[model samples]
Target: MAIFHTSIKTFSRGKGQSAVAAAAYRGGLLLSDFVTGQQHDYRRRSGVVESFCLAPPDAPRWALDPRELWAVAEAAERRKDSTVAREFEVSLPHELSEEQRAHLAFVIADALVGRYGFAVQASIHAPGTPDGLNHHVHILATTRRIGSEGFGEKTRELDVGPSGKVQVQWIREMVAAATNAHLEAAGLTDTIDHRSLAEQARSAIERGDDLAAAALSREPTQHLGKHAAALAGKGVATDKASTNDQIAEENREHYDFLVRKAGLEGKPAPVPGHEPVKRGGRVFNAETAGLPGGLELRGVSGVRLQNLLLSSHGHTPEQAPISLAEKILDALRDVEEISRARADLAMEKIRDALRWAQRQLSSQGETSELRQWVTNAALQVRALKSLIISRARRLLNVKSATRLRHMAEQEWERFNADCPPGSTRYSRSEWTLRRGRRLSVLEKHTAELKAAQERASEGELNAIDADILAKAELLAGLPHPSVSALRIAEPKPVPPDDLGSTRSVPRGPTFH
Candidate 1:
């Protein structure tokens, strides 16, 4: 299958990353950083089919050389926390030939330079694993624009603001479109989507396939970094990746079970223990509660029932009817469970973003202004965490309410079922009245659940947006080197330390 995978990351000194090293590794070359005096040699690396640099039409001819371009980039940056380069890693379809993949990569690279004025050094890598799958390309782009005069100012559109997101979206869509065009020309049947998992699930539901929607609705996993991915590839389990895999597998199993059960009965499968019963006069007790055949009545009280039916299900005692309280309570419990899962996922993402920002701050020499910014960001993260915790507490309440409601509903159903048809204990007219009341309560509860979900989603989006903006501001505040004085210098060796031996010291201080 052709999968859509694209990741954009920056190589910044703030994160202790070197642009020259990044270029060498991706381009499969032996390049030395003159500024840091560190050599990056990856020439022995296999599976790099092709590597080349792309520049704007107005760019100087000298900028076409990857080693020269990256060396200049390293020398141009004076700040300890400067953003050196931007990398776009994209997965190529294994179905495509080596030539086709290379062509696709070049097309994307050309688009990047043309649109963003960035000098792109692209490398098409063949699969390296034993199975020889996962062909991909690495695109290293200069932060500054290149022209006839020299490397101009940094490109802002690809760095921050709403424009940055738009650029990424444009690149992703272009990749998918270009790949599909090639596949279509080759008469291949497979295709890929740039939409997220949630978006895809919603589309599936709109197309009337509830099963497919459910199967696609699992929470998307976090990206595994290079080390974690490598370990996982070697049959080692990682905590986050393993948990996500298990969740995805469970969703698939549940989908399969639902499909098979539906097929056998030629109808929608009912939830276990949710089917209507005919028995009557059964009292609520511990024994009845434990049985799967009917609802349990042990450890239940009227106060608990009222809490579940009236409060948790969004109904008042006067508005709620006793007869259908069980159904409403069950529905409310389901909503709460789903909401809790979503809240937990949102919290995880916020925490991850905070950790990443903190790491960047810790790597660089801090200033007072930077410290203030970090403090503000930390407070925002703490506030978001508190909100999530508050929501979780509410969910705990819902769980308690649901337990009580289940017992009451079960006992009531049994009592009515055991009564004779004409018995006063099971009045048909009263049952009909209660059913109508239950419907009204259910509608109210449904509306509340929908509102709660929307609120949660909004909070998650807001948290992510704020995180991005804060991080961008932090990066923008970092100092940059004066582009006018940048000079391409040769790599120099470091001076050796004297060990009480008669070794001659270098005349001038060597650039370490």
Candidate 2:
């Protein structure tokens, strides 16, 4: 499928990013960073199909060269922490030939230069080896406007302020249009969409296409980012990629159920609404599989019908035996159970670390990295729990799956009702992360209160004291009194234990 992917990230000194090094990696060049006094050489880098630099008309001649361009760009920023550039990543259709993909990239680049008036360093990368659908473009753009006189004022409109998201939406729409135009010109029927799956589903429903709406209503796959995609190309699985694969399997199983339900009801076409079955659900078309035209296959099961279906297509008997679907489901369930148990144990360790980190946060002068790590770990746990629930959903029928969630909510409520006082009335592992974040905020306010006490006038001190007291009560869930003397102990580093995995059992005739 021609997928739609557009993301814009910043090259900012505050985030430890350098435009020169980024350009080197994206364009596969060897460049010296004047700002950092380092040489970045990516000339030996492979898989870069094409790379070029774009300058706005009337820009200085020196702006045409990427190395000099980024040097000037970094020097132009006066702040110790300033945004050097912005990168726009756009995915190209693998259905298009290499030349076609390159052309599409150029069109998108030109549109961006005209819109933003920045020098664009664009690179077109070849599709990934394992899965060939990752063909994409990397466009590094200056954050400032440029013209005949060279770089001008910062493009504050593009910064994450009032108009930032609106500008991003315009870029997304423009990219989608340009991609579809090129696909149409190349005589390809497949077109990409910029809107989310839910939005697309709503549009389908408005157009009175229930089947298309139902298909579109399924949750889309999570993005396998650059690192994860590279890992996948090397045949290494990531938690994110594994979760996406499981979601895809569940979607297919649901679609297969719809097909069977339609067949059993003697409908001309499959719509939606049904109980999903096991994994490895493969759809066999009557025309393609050489079955009788309009033949219903709802009740066709067991070894005999399975063989007939596979024999018509000349598929290997091991490819998709009827029992293999159930076997794969059982295997997946086993993997899910094992994974959930491990994750729950890991969650306890994370909670303990979180509690320690929160206590240490007040004393550490340089805890930005630790704070970010804490946030990332919390989000990771949330995603892990979601994937586990999704696995359970895939194994059960519709009502059972829905009830599983409702029951979970009820159980959590009951837990809270039975929990002792001084608690947050929530799951401790989840509350641990929340409390850690709140502790950071409380410490900030406490410091502010002390600082204000030292320097503020009477009126200002009174207001500051009131705000601090409220903040301490709300943010820290602590009692009144003793706002200062907040020195805390340092946290010792303890490396996390790596997780192990159990592979899914392969399928063959076990004579089920």
Candidate 3:
């Protein structure tokens, strides 16, 4: 499958990130940052297929070298807050040959240079794996325009703003188009989409394929950073990586069940909550079995679903009670609705935060501390919204759930053992005064924000009204048509040279 993956990040000195270090790691080279007096050597790193740098036509020839280019970039900027470079990491399609992949990367790099005039150092990497997957590229782009003289001013248009968002969208679209063209040329059928999973899900729903929409709408797993990913690839499991593995396993099981259900396409619909017959074999409920078609059990309690499937093909006495496919389809529809609702809630929170932020920016002046606070608050709200959405998508692992249940059971046993005879332990109230205080604090903050916005609105209206009055007074003082004709008839047009001289035109009536 050709999966789409692209991420953009900045290499900034403020965040303690060095362009030289980033360049060395991606290009598999040895480089030393002169400004920071630190050395970065990744020559021993494996799986780097190809690496090269691209620059503008007028850029010096030496600028094509990664070490020289980044070192120059670092030395040019005196500010500690300077952004040295922007990096774009994209996963290349494994379906294409190494040559084709390299070509695709160059095309993207050329587009980046053409659009932003930033120098790009692109590297294609193919990690060695059992499946020989994980082909990807890293494109480190200078944050400034490269000229014949050297690096010019920073490309402020590519900073965080509307223009930057448009630039990102253009890059994503261009990559998708280029990848599709190459796939077509190679006579391959697979394609990749640059859109988010939620967007793809919405499109599937509009196309009337709810099943596909559900499949496409799974919550995305968290991205493991380079070090974590490398460790996990080497069979070392971090906490998040382990959670992702469990989720992947669960999804695979669900997908296989769906596939098995799909095989029984023409079968009759299964009765909901059907009980198993116990004459020769035990029958499992369609819903309880969590399978698309119901399974019949043969003289066994607590047998695994896989074992039941292997044993029942020849030995089962009665026809399978219900179609598992229909049940699975129903469950998918339900899950799809829940996922859509959650997505809608997340979007609503984001929209509200954006609206509030816009209002704060527009109403408050540049020097207002309140305005800055509002801006920070808006950012925090947006971050919280994202956290909420991500948390909502997280599925509870079966093993974790079972462990928690066992822990609770043990706690109950201990509590009963410790209880005195004929005495009872009353349940504690879940709500507390601390919770109330937090709620009150939140309410106070909301009230303060509302009052501030009201004051800003009044000030803006007053300023607008005063400006309107002044403009009206100025217009009232302007000469009438009759007076203007008299003035025009009295004066001759000034010559070109005299216009630059200290010559003055006849003055019109002035407003007080």
Candidate 4:
């Protein structure tokens, strides 16, 4: 991808700048400043690949020539500290051919002319060195609108607090859009984004594309201008140059690590002192073995939690791919199928990592590091087991309760049809009492679910709470399901009724 960079600045006499000299240097021309009667000789200047001027349809003929245009621009501004011209400097992608680059420059120049009615003097500059990729264009635009009569009032809207910031942003976006369009037309996969790195990263993550997100998560380097760049080119380190080098290296390492971590690359990411462990003629992680994020004190379920988090973010469950091992286990009636394939691969990697840790404990001698690692690893493993068992139990109990509720409903239907309310089978008062007791138990489960809400993380809640919540609410909303009660807690026997009834409903159905 190409970098998105475009900037606007002004040549102000207050800042000791001359529009005539600036334009001459950019266009490789020799011209006199009509204002100061100053002759600026830049005809010997090299590296200019193209230079031209663009004017509005109603502009005077003199505005069409770079020399005449800037001369008039300087003459038009008379104050000692007057603002002379506005400049737009944009980098051109080295990936484009010369003709394409020139065409892009024309598009940008035409846009400026159409928007501001300014006479635009543009120069496309070659890189300082043939091997360099610093190809770019410099635009010197007049502050006033050009007409057949002459330069008119200054474009005050370009000031900072006014529409200036907005116009500059539009230019940035325009560069990005136009560059991408040309790249696509050229059949090049490279493109550009006008957003900041952080903004791009968030967008990628929101779309659930972590790989692209990882690439964008990197810190971008600072630009080194002419002097600092020259010094750095000669191998002298400057502060900015050093910082840029560090950022570039860090970005490279981070991207490489993420790619390797995500299993997009088979080669393990580099670590300062760690060496690859060669075993069975295969490369071993040496650190994680196969774990996601080497030595992380988390179980495979952590990956599951990540997927759950994604699902909780308004994404469909199918869009949040839980690990494949989970999928395979679910394919064994573990849970509903998820469509994501990335997590499935991550799951198998996690299993291998766990076994590796376990083997280390069995084979290696005791040490402080090993002890700490084992302690964390053991806790994660045990917690994972407990989590699995707890989920399985909850699912089984809810399923049983559902069936029992169904049975109870059927019994009520049958009793209502055949055995009337006043029939000898069961008294209306007794049925009402039993029904109230069942509702009380359902309320207990509902309370349990509600309480669990406070303790559960968003991940666990989405993964487990959804089913439990739905089932609990379903049972509570229905006429008390079972005669005995839900399996949540043991049922209390009914006390002696006023009619001298002593039979107790069996303690809630027991789950193995």
TM-scores of the candidates are: 0.49, 0.52, 0.50, 0.51
Per-residue lDDT value at 282 in model 3: 41
Residues 1-512, candidate 4: write the lDDT tens digits: 35567888998999999988999889888988777788988877656766878787567768877768888888888788999999999888877755567667776777677678888888888665313467789988999998979899888888787588777766776666567556655767566667687877786688666667667767778888888877874557899988987998997788777757767555444322112222233422212121121111122222222233233334443344333233223222211111121122123323443344445545663344434433433333334344444564444334333433443344345445665556764578876664554455445445544444443545764676455444323323322212122332355666897889896656887799
Give candidate 1 regions above 4 Å deviation.
128-131, 207-209, 258-512
Q: Which residue runs does candidate 4 get wrong by more than 4 Å?
A: 129-131, 264-512
Off by over 4 Å in 2: 261-512
How many steric overlaps does candidate 1 have?
A: 6
lDDT of each: 0.60, 0.62, 0.59, 0.60
> What are the C-alpha RMSDs, in order, of all predicted structures?
30.8, 28.9, 32.2, 34.6
2 or 4: which has the higher TM-score?
Answer: 2
| Highest lDDT model number | 2
Residue-level lDDT for 250 in candidate 4? 91
Write the residue-wise lDDT of candidate 2 on 1-512 in tens digits. 67888999998898888999999999889989887799999997765766777776557767768879988998888887899989999999977755467657876787677667889899887555444457899999999989888899888889897699888877887777667656756877566778787877786688676666676677678878779988986668799999999998998887787667667877544333221211245454333232222212111011222334455444554543223223323323333333433442323334444455554554553344554444444434444444443333223223222332333344345444555435855567766554554344345434534443344445654654454344323322321111111222345445444554444455887775
Model 1 scores a C-alpha lDDT of 0.60
**Winner on TM-score (1 vs 4):** 4
Please rank every candidate by lDDT, starting with the best: 2, 4, 1, 3
Candidate 2 yields a Cα-based lDDT of: 0.62
Error of 1 at 243 (Å): 2.5
Task: Rate residue 184 of model 1 by lDDT.
Answer: 49
Assess candidate 3 and give its lDDT: 0.59
